[model samples]
Target: MTIPLPGLDLQQLGPEQSLRAFIGWWPDAQTRLYLAEQAVQAQVIYGGRMMHADHFHLTLAFLDGSSVSVLQALAENMADWPVPAITLDLTLRDVFEKPQVVWAGPDESQRQALTVLDQWHEDIWARLTALGWTQPPRRFRPHVSLLRHARIAADQSHRHALPTQAFVGDGVGLIVSVPGEQRSQYHLAATVNPGRAVS
Candidate 1:
């Protein structure tokens, strides 16, 4: 199978047995590079494993281990899943210490945008639940994981201020995650445009 985006070639990503997919929005090349640089900076400040820049994405829903037929059906059905274009301002650098994750996400300043993202997530989750997929029992929080296994002291851990970086997303992708020792590899199996579906 072959799927092509502006700078991505899915043919090279190879095949998958089951569609262990998630619905998410992918950033463009420039935003990707910026995220990677932020990861590097975070790694320098807090000792941890920095994520690959190419893997940076805003995940909406996790749909694990569905069949390829389901992927096809979802792609077709998503033409009616009209998502408005959203600009995510990455201004907050925070940590999920229990998970040892250092991440970036929209701050309180972008409350309206965050509200939109929350609603979008709820809409996708509802659709997935109706499809009989088990929902993970966690509140939706839109974040781009920058680094993993970060160790910080109690007083040292706080939200870091950074110059606002923006990522504009107009579509959602059905992405399959391939496991790896260093970092998980993600392949874009299909996409649902704000106005249409592309596969």
Candidate 2:
């Protein structure tokens, strides 16, 4: 009797076990610098673990339950959707504990972005549902994730507020990452450039 060993490609198995997608803003250099400094200081002061500064992003939408190809197509369409560059001014309202996670609340502008994104999520959700996909259970929030897990004390909050920076989202991208890795790094599977119509 001959037995066959399963041949697997590790690269195909990423930090995540499921197919995940998110629409977010990638900050420019100046914004990245300011956030990095704040994260470092927060780490020392609050003892809260800091996310990789280079990976800092503002997630607008999250979706699961679609194939990579489907997500890629969605991203391609979004990149082609014509929309003006959105300018946001973020102000931290307060620090709040929501069950398992701690997050920084956003001001009016951030809330506005949340509203816009919520509508977009609905639109995408309908499309995916039509394609026979189930969505995740998490409710949408416009806040930025400051620290995760309670291992870090409340004292770890940054003494100085994070400075504000502006960025124009040039395109929408499809990103995928594996689970259990030290960092969840994503590659641009597709790029949807703004100010253009979908083909």
Candidate 3:
């Protein structure tokens, strides 16, 4: 994961202001470039609005409509959250019908990394619950969304195959979603490095 520089002034935010935010892992430039290339190919095969490279991320927790105070608290306590260093292999190309999205996810063969990631997800949610946030009941399905509004059938999702690509994920960031005319723009608010001592 890339350590993102602050893009929003959290200190300037008013207490009642609500933010559409989430904590996620940002890929390094090289990995992002690779994903962008894959997205271009996927768009040709799948037909959809390809997500911009800058918008690519692996979401951990979606905190929609979170109050400024809650966001601030999360940022302040971020260093205390567990961030296990893991390597994710993006080789599974698939689609979700409800959202009409094409995405890349780790294949089942990456057991060790997937296990660590699963535990880390649970740990983060445990910390979030202490901050008065409720964990969503939905199961965690980790994937990097590549295209939206895709017009591909379910079986066509496997028409194209991805070569083995791996990236080290060792950090997390708080990102605010800014709605745009075409798609939502994401702004990095704060980040915490992996293996930092918990306060």
Evaluation by TM-score, superior candidate among 1 and 3: 3
- TM values, all candidates: 0.79, 0.63, 0.88
Badly placed stretches (over 4 Å) of model 2 are 1-18, 72-77, 82-84, 93-105, 109-117, 135-137, 150-162, 167-170, 179-181, 194-199
Give the alpha carbon lDDT tens digit for every residue of 1-199 in model 2.
Answer: 0001122232454433456666555555555555566555554544556656555556655664446556544654564443334455444523444432334334554656657656766665666566555766777655545554434445454323445544323344455553445755555554446434211
Clashes per candidate (backbone, < 3 Å): 0, 9, 1
In candidate 1, which residue pairs get closer than 3 Å at backbone N, Cα or C atoms, i.e. clash?
A: none
Winning model by TM-score: 3
Error at 92, model 2, angstroms: 0.8
Say which prediction, candidate 2 or candidate 3, comes out ahead on TM-score.
3
Query: Model-by-model lDDT, in order?
Result: 0.72, 0.49, 0.78
Which ten residues in a row are the worst by lDDT in model 2? Answer: 1-10
What's the best-to-worst order under lDDT?
3, 1, 2
Error of 2 at 21 (Å): 2.8
Q: For candidate 1, lDDT tens digit of each residue in 80-172?
A: 675755667888889887888888888877877888888888888788777667789887888888998887666565689877888755346
lDDT for 123 (candidate 3): 84
Residue range 28-128, candidate 3, lDDT tens digits = 77678888988998899779898887777788888778888889888888855556668678888888877888898887788997788788788888988
Candidate No. with top lDDT: 3
